[model samples]
Target chain A: MRIRKLIPGVDANLLIKDAGKLMQDPMRRSFLRGAASLGALAFLTGCDIIDGDAAEGVLRKISELIDGAQAALVSRTKLAPTLKESDITRPFPFNAYYTEDEAPAVDPATYRLEVSGLVDNKKPWTLDELHALPEVSQITRHVCVEGWSAIGSWQGAQLSEFLKRIGADTRAKYIWFKCAEGYTNTIDMPTALHPQTQMTFKFDNKILPRAYGFPMKIRMPTKLGYKNPKYVVAMEVTNTDHGGYWENQGYNWFGGL
Target chain B: MTAETMTASQDAPIHPGWVRICHWINALAILVMIGSGWQIFNASPLFDFTFPRSIALGQWLGGAIQWHFAAMWVLVINGAVYVTLGIVTGRFRRKLLPIYPRDVVADAKAALTFKLAHDDLAHYNAVQKLLYAGVIIVAVIVVLSGLAIWKPVQFQELTALFGGYDFARYVHFAAMAAIVSFLVVHVALALIVPKSIRAMIAGR
Candidate 1:
């Protein structure tokens, strides 16, 4: 009767019959015998349908738990699979919240990458100056969160190398990027230092086209496409959490693939 | 045992509460997963045509992913419980295992020609055993491949085992198709033999 009261709207007689059946079934009895623990009961109660902000808060906590678990599991040394040049998707489909024509056009002459926050250098580097840094290229798959993928060749300076050049605090928790299109995102320090996390300025062996985050994009093969900010014009390193556009919109903050 | 003994077995309790409860829960979880997965796939369809919006659970990609990830935990936990209990109770051995090659061929022929036996609803024929076994294996693969795709960098070894991220997706989609086909046959057979469904629900 007390259990029926706790379960609210359920028919008490039906619950009793099911419980009686469970007791008679050896397999079910054994399975559920251990489930009498308070923790299991609490978990089941938590999963019950509830109303309003309380339920939303529970869901958010679950998401946060998933994010923490995923963050813990990421490996710094693991690399996204790389494909051969011939394997690249020809005429790679462009994807964004906006159409290709709506892509922001930044004037190359005036474009300067500003570095600040937890960095010794607060200077701005022009496209030429950033491009002149040591270049590295890789042919890796760009995996979109939306269930499609495209292989493309990306060339740029390693983000870790660039971070060091800017005299950034390597121990900082996050490396946030601000793009010309008003897009902002952040990556963990380990991801920021990953060998494949590049400040990409070239695609298919040419200056990055406007369609593909021209001027510069953080080409993070290790992360989902959304985590890789494009047209990045400013960056900051900080210990405080700065949730990204999609992340703030309920997408997983880690956004690792 | 003789045919009489086999017939008598049908009257005895065959479906346990664990099996029945887990079965229905798994079915519900899988249906949610499939619908949400289709919604997610529709966001970036591999082929030209898109999955109809009517059958999809969540209208948007973000909402679909939430549904997917939520259902994923249910599927994984329920499936794990089923598998662990099956192995522990030796139910798999008693109900579906050691399917001989001869039995399979004979069963296949009998099934194709509509000569399959249903006198003992409690017992599994060689074909039924094989299908059940195959589905369990495929379910495990689907879960593992789903994990690999979900966290390629974290589960790098698992992803490498499936060849790569793209190949992992291929495997996941293919496994889903296999499960869907199995569901079709399973539901059809249940409809053809409504008694088995009743036995599952009431533990006759």
Candidate 2:
């Protein structure tokens, strides 16, 4: 009674009015009492809710929608945090769908990076030619979709500058990459043009090792680790999204970090 | 006619239609988010222990991500509507505000002793008010930390506030744990006071 006095919604008049009905129809009241859980179960199982393939489709649609949302959220001026050389995770973790030993072994001298689609220069690029392009170094975190992160010092040519050098159509919607290991991915044009996006040829000031995607890797600091394809052998500027490896398997296509 | 009028006039529903609708939707969204989130947590667990697959939703990491991202829109939009309507209708103020700490201690003592009067299903004791308000805040915290984790670089400042990309995962999990705790208590109370369930369902 003392505690009831402090309750915000307690009304003595309402309680008193309700008192007479409490014991009048005991059996019916007991049945109604038992119905509460049943009612909730029924509500949950209601036909209005979706299920099976229909539910999966809806979830897929929403995941697809987030790609647009992530695209909008991305800003060129806001770069992934650049870390000091000391901050680079030692022996930066090697990650791929396959084991590290199975990473594509490409002969650096013979490798040629094929460029196609909406570009004036459909010419394939050699490793020496890629090296000839101006280079910049960046130390940034590579955040994985599975929820681990590592910072690595990467050296490469700015992808945006390379696009200009290749005369790739800037209006193209996507920049698709194919790796020597058969890994494939497509990133949006804006992300491709992000200043920090690199067509990496070196790691820690050395020719990129096979463990690090070797011949070449396109590093997008703004994206998840999987989005950064290594052992890159071919690239195209196209309006078409030639669906990616993990993305086709239900991962968000954007994979924006 | 006279009997019907008397019944109608006396037994007004405690929850409005919008409140009940939002409540059920929120329940579904929260369940999906938590279940799938548990599965995602198990992929690269922060703690030593992992949630069992029996309790978690989604078969694997990719599937878990799809459900988590999918249900987020529903949770966020429904929660917004619930909060907006609660404030607009003055229900929050009338039902949950003026929660005195003194009353909370007294009410908690009564509850422990099984002497608390909850016969009035519409009126909330101070403890209930605190839990309801607190859970709302915790829900918001989870969403923000999730955003920070989802696009840590894009939302770097937000990530930094929660500590960093790695630590934000812990913040996200902690907020989820808080929500889960609230649900446990809330469900227990509903079962204990079964009439509250009817009040919520029928809004009476």
Candidate 3:
């Protein structure tokens, strides 16, 4: 069959030899050609194997390398930019794996902060006791791994002071957090000791709302939001990694900003 | 002339062997970066639309980030080498500099009419120089914004240049769009004049 000429000066038959190729425009054809190139690159790098487990294994290792690069860039002295009170995002975004209503409700009356593993004190403490420690607050941007951010004021106990109070083995590599919602996460010791890292008890001068991790949240402005676990029920200072909920599912553990 | 001299005298290859190698490697790295970056962008889209899933590289956000970071190394190092070699060999001056606006306007008009000649591979039309030069600047912007997002605190000055952590993302996306535009035109021209593609591959 003869094809209709699409352009006045050009014959359609000359432009495309096959009906299959003709169906798609040149731009789309080249875009798909890019996908083909994606396959070639995947074959060469062995990391984009979307259909197989082999790809995940390679990609995960590369993620670890990136984590190292990010970690190396971090300086204990350098702090994430602090925002003015006026800069705070009104109704800061509520984000979680579950719905907002589903956020874990840990009664402040019953909440007991458990401490263990390489700590001089393994004793549990009440929320009231945590509140009594010297208080601090700062307005800072909370960067999420998913590529969103919101500036908010957070008030809490300095993590370094608390760690020192418990005589936590600060030399240990990690500080693992267990949350009331079965969420878990870990941060390196330097991050644990970062001036901005806090055992946050309040958001915007009020007790943290459930959607923002009621009772407690570990706030690390230098790291992505996921690295800042919320509704933290327990913390263990340890050398072992004990990868968290998202980390095990393939999110990079470092997750630095 | 003797046979050896005769062979040497034959139309010399337009692209050097180093240029061809760098060109291909850079192309592959860009594909990986764009593909994976789109997957990441899909996680929490900046705009209303997202790049289709088929066009994205890695299957998931973490996986995409992995590809993005891995290809980042290749892109950075290869780009550095390309720029260094471009300077050392004066490829920049000879092929892509002194792009007069008059020439660009004429060439653009020729291009739109499909009258621009690409058969002569030894010299580039004004449009090609403008694009090549513009894309290099865009590439640098993309990398800088990426670093600002990656380590905002350590690279605070860079982040501040783009108006801080969140704003840097916009800059990165804009730069990516610019690059994709360049690629579309580049690949389209390569299709229109297939010899350019052959010359790129065969260093002729």
Q: Which candidate is the best by DockQ?
A: 3
Give stretches of model 3 more than 4 Å off.
A1-51, B1-12
TM-scores, all candidates, are: 0.80, 0.86, 0.88
Clashes of each: 1, 0, 1
Interface RMSD of 3: 11.5
Q: Write the per-residue lDDT of candidate 2 for residues A1-257, one digit (tens) a residue.
A: 22122112222232222223332444212221221122232454534233435545666788888877766767745689898988888867776655566678999778999999999999888888999999899999998777778888889999999999999999999999999978899988988999999999889999889989988999989898889999999999999999887786667998887
Cα lDDT of candidate 1 equals: 0.78
Report model 2's TM-score to 2 decimal places: 0.86
lDDT, candidate 1, residue B108?
91
Best by TM-score: 3
Badly placed stretches (over 4 Å) of model 1 are A1-60, B1-12, B101-121, B160-163, B192-195
Q: Model 3, range A3-59, lDDT digits (tens) per residue?
A: 543322222342233223323444222322233345546565433444245555666
Mind giving the per-residue lDDT tens digits that candidate 1 earns over A121-231? 999999999999999999987877776678899999999999999899999999989988788998889999999999999999999999899999999998888898888
Tens-place lDDT per residue, model 1, B94-168, is 999889989999999998899998887768999999999999999999999999889876687898899887788
TM-score of chain A of each: 0.79, 0.80, 0.81
Look at candidate 3 and give me any clashing residue pairs: A257-B150
DockQ, all models:
0.14, 0.21, 0.29
